[model samples]
Target chain A: MTLNWKSGGVLLGVVFFLAVALVKPIGVSTQFVIFDGILWNAINPDVVTTTADGFTSPNAYLAKSGGKYAEAVANPINYSFIFVLAMMVGAALSVLARGGLSREERAMPELWRSTIGGSSLKRYAVAFVGGFIVLYGARLAGGCTSGHMMSGMMQTALSGYIFSAGAFAAAVPVAMFMYKEV
Target chain B: MTSIILAIVIGAAFGATLDRVGATNPSLIGRMLNLTNLHLMKTILLAIGVGSILMFGGQMIGLVDVGHMSVKAAYIGVFIGGLLLGGGWAMSGYCPGTGVCAAASGRKDALFFIAGGLFGAAAYMGTYPAWKASGMLDDIAGGKVTLGTVPGASYEGLTAISGDLLGLAIGAVFVLVAFVLPDTASRSGGQVQPAE
Candidate 1:
């Protein structure tokens, strides 16, 4: 459980794919739609009809598809969100197993220190900013990295490639700039 | 029922692996942003390789049905969203999934990222009417098309043959590069301080 890059990368890929193949494809943003669909139906059942199969009716489709106000309150737990939840559990187990679970000082990059104004503050800021960008992009793009790149590419979808390329293109330069000051 | 159970198990495993690999740490991810650590890149590549082989191979052997998968094409949105996401990643050091993982690991900063994301999502919902009226979601044609549809091949053909072959090649390249590359601070040499 040394958590080297190679092993970590391989594990991530394998676990992600297994999740897709065995259950559902890995996506981070799909939760929004599913939640939206459920909520819309719950509030105004008339506005959101239910199919004979127990799925959301066509009336609610727009909210689910477009992620309107009603959709956000309906379903609190989405599949992708659940997947994210699992990822946290997995990460915690990994840390505990490695005996790295204590809340202690960990090494941080210098640029981060300057940006957040404090070591801990920087972590929150980075997460907030990153999440905002990612969620916004997920909304705009209609999917997140796991949905578009990982699962999409697995099925050979053309858009997946485009999204993946874009992600890497952005990730590399930014990563280089931030880490150089470390 | 099976899928849900499987999802929970797999999700836990995925999260654990991310944590073990140091992916839950902002600094580790930041290293990738700075190019000091190619670990993230290598991890992504390897994941792609492994996933391709498993999924495509399962399809080829008739063990899995690839047809049930959903692939939607929101071309304009993906493009613009990607740009914004990349910029944000540069400024912040975490992604949605990693940010959540970081927070779960008791990183206080990750909480900010989570709060920011919730606000952003809520904000998007509140402003949906204007965005929809602005026609940002219109005129989209691409839906579920893959490499197989472009040429003389079918989806199965592309995934089973071309996709599989390419995945293997890419995986091999990653293995080669990882072996040949020198150890940087992010790779093997950096001394990780005991968790606080």
Candidate 2:
């Protein structure tokens, strides 16, 4: 494949260098936190604020970010949210440039077809639910794979290693069950 | 507005690079997890390995900030969350970051996944009080601690080393593992070949 480990790794490494040089760190989950804060602020601004000095969030996990969510919600045009949206633009350009958009986007693996069958709705539903669960877990954990595993692990943070190990432990078995049909 | 523009520039490059690497491909992700195509894992390790070098190495040269380096709280919630995210990844072939890129790549399933993730976030926000009161959110290992500063975590009762040194050692291991992993991965799971 053109996008093999060597090629892909080099591309990501460059991205990382740019991210650190141009930004503080690279991560993805805080985008969701900002999403939540925006929604809540729209509904009731009272929920996220505590005092003049700081603001509060419903999830203590976000609060642990040292007021990141509060600031993202209040200002809404900061580094994390911008980084998140930029990722989308980056991906879209890549697809269009590579003619990936022209290719038929199909469910991965025969497992998706043989088991789930030809139901677009089921595919969507599964993706949606999986998305929801993962987002929830990511918020609770204070980061996602990119936020913790990628950025934090690079710093040799303990949580990064633990999270990586835990994720691999659960993911490998679940994948075997899904794919092997065992 | 400056930050927004910067974000767009940076984000565009990030998204494009991710696509170039096939990080947006669900089949590749599934195969990696299946242990058939070890390329994806190897790629991830390489990225992390190299990133650690740049980050810590940069600090020594005054290019990066050791102070600005944010270490997450070493708590149990993170582990459980990682497990769920991992399972979600294996099941759906999309994690939070990759899912966004997938959506942008125009995969309908990925778009729906993003919507689902949003709905999930809203649900979590709605139930925040009860969840927080459960005390799981309380820091267990006590406030932000890195691998080099954890209180009880130990390897043979040896104390932690400098974060930079640890970063280097781990980076080396990742680099070695990425190079050594076999290129072939079991494709027993599907009919779809690697994207051309």
Candidate 3:
């Protein structure tokens, strides 16, 4: 798809503003909710067990009232998660509208292919491993890149700056390695 | 009903912007990493600037509630976690949210990223006992501490004092960098861009 900086900039700004004003601020932690719901049912079925008449478990109630589990579940409903979900939907619609939804040729940089190995499966493995690492970091840090950088910075939180700096410091070198062949 | 509908619409808009800006592409993100194209940086900075001004201003005018906002504190675990995440981003080219976005847009690799993230989260949960036993969770400190909390101050007082300083610093740096950097087309790479 054709891309231009000016339009891109304006669009990002508009969406970001609307996100904060209408939906919620940008963040990636909401995905954790979907994850939590899945986990709660799987790990401690008693915690999430539903009664025949549709009452949730007492443990689920207590867990939701206070604890790390509660915190995790709460995040999914926050504005940040909604905003991120909106972003995904928006992105898909745009591609479809532009007739750019067709499968394009897979482009691989030589260095990346060599280092990560040249199969889509290998690349996916890398993506999965990488995603896990980043999310784990997000949980530990109390937020993801968008929450820390975009939302946190807007509030002038010091942690936001630290998170952004740390993310970039790690991103640059790896980016160089990943894109060297390109 | 309104919030949910607003959510879907807004989410669509956000996703559209990422796609249009080529942010959905790992190569574009990688380019931002290499400092060749700063579109992502610019977009990010501009978003921060605009959002900050709006939020801060809203707070000042009683349109927003600053006190109700949630903020995480500084902790050693966060530092270590950030480091690991940064390294992963550099290595894999995707983050959590963007990974979902990319996958939704039909990028195969992003699906893997999502799976991996699920597994990693589960692993962390499974190992919680060992992690806590290791004292990793002990004595962690920090909770909603802002500049206003640091000293004798009112919310308005702190906002006035810090806002000017941060605005000036961030604005100046953004202008300087934008002026200095030349736009380059996105790089072509095999990796799918992760959500940030």
Candidate 4:
């Protein structure tokens, strides 16, 4: 059974607290970069190389911070990378424990049908495009909601607050435009 | 090894919490942003608020290390990127974290989202130098600074106020908003059905 919004909200807060207090703040977007580095390194071995100091890459971005990103690429089984993979595994297990995806989950969502009024194919395409834009933006910003917004704000970081403001400044307008009242 | 195990445990818990909160559904996210439903938004704000209180309080009592805190450098790109991310988030129901979780929950559409994210990340990597040259990545507004001074942390504070107290105040506000907010701001409503 799903949690009511109140309980779910508190639970999510606790999970994030544990993550920050114990090891580090929760983040997922950087793993996306590491994933790309992994794939690129696999295709071209020269992309990441062991240097006298540490791992280095031909790409400037990968080579920054003393090739830390390159090191993750060469050895993909690190904390952040594995954490991302585990998130998927965790989601899968949660779904399985509840039996499986429900009919409403597996099918097109009701809000989508009533508001957007499109086939599932259109939804998928829009979802894909949306994901692409967000990831690109996340990389550009060097963080996503979990990192800059959630974790940043929790830490009282000024950047986090700025990013959150910027995010909502755009998100609210876009959502209103897209899902106008019938 | 311990860190690896912690990663798995924490990641799993994080993912499960996301699913339980209905974040694995795109439509729910859409509803939240559109103000048709605020269940997910309330959950997110509450979580952030509580987490902030625990973390800052833990830091004050010496239970949590300030050294572990990471402060990303502020830049023009971050704000611009945030704007773009917000727009995309409104359009797509998934962000990086939720997209992967949604795929795991067996949404075929989420798979496409993940693929798109991968491609988008790679594109950023390819164009990194250009963006860097454009100065969007340059530090702005006391780069890597905090709202208030946090003891034992390296980042400078914009003010002399205690960071811990400031965090607590903001966290309380978030919690208060979460509690006070209606389930739906839409005039058409009763309790809007959750995406479930």
Candidate 5:
């Protein structure tokens, strides 16, 4: 009776159905790639990836519409980006409605303090650093938890299963190593 | 136009789901990762397990396009990347999907973690050339193969078992394991049932 288990499963089913009704299976990792596009457009507009005739590279699905700087900026605003933005909005609403917005009673401050050492800056830094490393790998590997694990598994793709196995195989040991002090 | 609208609807549901399940709560995730609390595992496994069944089953009835499913190309890099992603998940207590929702739900710390993700993603994108040149990203074993191998299977010959059927069977196990795992209540404010 601790956590509400049924809601998440039901919601995922809903998401899958709606997503199928609208776009392809929903995934969030593409948002990261879009973020990369936005950053690149901001930094160096000329440094764009494209096919021979300057069309958006087919592999670069986000910018499939193809344009110059506008496309670069617009590239990040695809389905995945919208999904991510909505994710924040949805989460915000949930928190507000659920009445658990207190920063004072945040979850797992102790585990974080003990595992990564007690420093807000350190925690933020570790999260960012870890995020960066993880994203790098995720992008290289072609997906993240949602895109690879959830979406792929649903489709019964080997890549999905393989990634899941590899993730747990690595995650358990990493968790063990990181929390060794505890 | 239409895409954004769909995204909004999808995102809200997905995000709310994350919140309801305690998936947005980093502390809850941390406990799950610690292998101490097992409540979240059931939720996660159940979600994936059931998801697989529905997705494939839907395709069977033409409710979903088996072709539209986006499968990542399998390569050695995938496993290597998985390890990195897993390490990051353990360290940050947030995956890209959960992190964004967590941040939006008022987890300020998740924002930082997400910032890290952005930077991490940027690093990878910036070095895309080197990664591709490394040959690790090359598809191995004819990437995007399905788990099943029945005639007319989505991916033919990867295995004798049908991919969707296998997924359904495995997903059932996940649901079983989630229920069977010992439940321990979280010590954190966000604590849930731990195990029996």
Candidate 6:
């Protein structure tokens, strides 16, 4: 049961509008940082410390923004962190409610099958490598598609436009090169 | 307390919307980027355009608070990172948000994506000091500036044009482009077929 792209677009727009209109813009990559801090702090007790000022970390990245990241590490139950977890739950619910994957979804995508037919293992490896590159870039940029491009552009932030240009600039060429058959 | 509840509701809605739109499907994402199919691209453009209109329009009439606007700082690193992200996106078919959502949809492969993301984030953390020393993080191009002036917003404008109106204009253009775009850029790739 796939949604029509038009309706899906409008619905996605409305959701984004409400989020920005109400509390704050939606972001995801920062949560990755918080996740790292949580893991790092678990391994090393001194990585994060609570002080009168709230929270601080020995690591500069976690300690930057006036210990904001550090505070999130110390208190993982914040709005942004919970939001990421909730996103997962929501996706799961959507799939479950639909009964099961449609036949189209269950099989290898046509493009993948046609161009790079291989074991699921190969696809999984590619996905992992891709995720790593995207996340690493997101960290360097301080946001991902959600934070920098979508929300940022909606807010008319200059950096958002620049990021979009840079993203499409690289994405289009890479996709073209990789999927020559299609 | 209220914010936390709102987060769940919003985040869920966000994720469900992504799933319904096929953003969680790596294959579909690949098709979109490859220009084989433009369905997802149109959806993305339309969504951004409509969302922008509502937001900028709401702020114009005081329905949305100007102070709530969050503009990310501009820096050379952001642009470089964006280029890297684009390359990765073309290769992987998933971004951070979509990767998480994809995993939740019971795609075992997405789990590896998540692990990779975690490792990537940690790598960034470990190399943070070196990045900082490189001065790429330093703000540039009027740091946190907007395209046009937004009254009461903390960020400065690169131009004196009204930010709200500028946003609306750009949003309208996006909507127009979305309508004009075809389903597929290539004739051979008119419609994606279901796997046999």
Using TM-score as the measure, which candidate wins? 4
User: How well does candidate 1 score on lDDT at residue A139?
Assistant: 67
Q: Per-residue alpha-carbon lDDT of model 5 for A1-182, expressed as tens digits?
A: 22466566656655765675467777776577676667766677554555665535323334333633234344656667778889889878987887866764353345676666667777777778878877877877788888888777766677887788878887777676676432
Which lDDT tens digits does candidate 6 get at residues B27-102? 7788788787788898888889999999899999999988888999999989988998898888877889988988
lDDT of 4 at B70: 88
Position B8, candidate 3: lDDT: 77
Which candidate, 1 or 4, would have the higher lDDT against the true structure?
Answer: 4
Instruction: Report clash pairs, candidate 4.
Output: none
Tell me the interface RMSD of every candidate, in Å. Answer: 3.1, 2.1, 3.3, 1.3, 2.5, 1.4
User: Can you tell me the DockQ of model 3?
Assistant: 0.47
**Ten residues in sequence with the least summed lDDT for candidate 6 chain A:** A102-111
TM-score of chain B of 1: 0.74
Candidate lDDT (C-alpha), each: 0.61, 0.73, 0.60, 0.86, 0.71, 0.85
Model 1 error, position A83 (Å): 2.8
Docking quality category of candidate 3 according to DockQ thresholds: acceptable
DockQ score for model 4: 0.76
- Give a tens-digit lDDT track for model 5, residues B1-196: 8888888988888887778888776666777776767667767777776776776667667676666665667898888888888888888788888888877766667778788887887677557667778898787887867767523444553677766577678767766776776666333445454343
Q: Please, what are the lDDT tens digits per residue for candidate 3 over residues A21-84?
A: 5545666754654465556756765554433433343443224323444443434564445656
Badly placed stretches (over 4 Å) of model 4 are B187-196
Query: Which lDDT tens digits does candidate 4 get at residues A95-118?
Result: 888898866666555667678875
Question: Model 3, stretches more than 4 Å misplaced?
Answer: A1-3, A39-44, A49-85, A101-117, B62-68, B128-142, B146-176, B184-196
Once superposed on the true structure, which residue ranges of model 1 sit more than 4 Å away at CA? A32-62, A66-81, A101-111, A114-123, A176-179, B129-141, B149-196
Go through the candidates in order and give each one's DockQ: 0.50, 0.61, 0.47, 0.76, 0.56, 0.73
lDDT of 2 by residue, B28-118 (tens): 6776777766778888889988887776677667776555566677677788888888888887888888899988887888887788888
DockQ of 5: 0.56
Error of 4 at A175 (Å): 1.7
Best by lDDT: 4
Q: Which ten residues in a row have the lowest lDDT in candidate 6 chain B?
A: B187-196
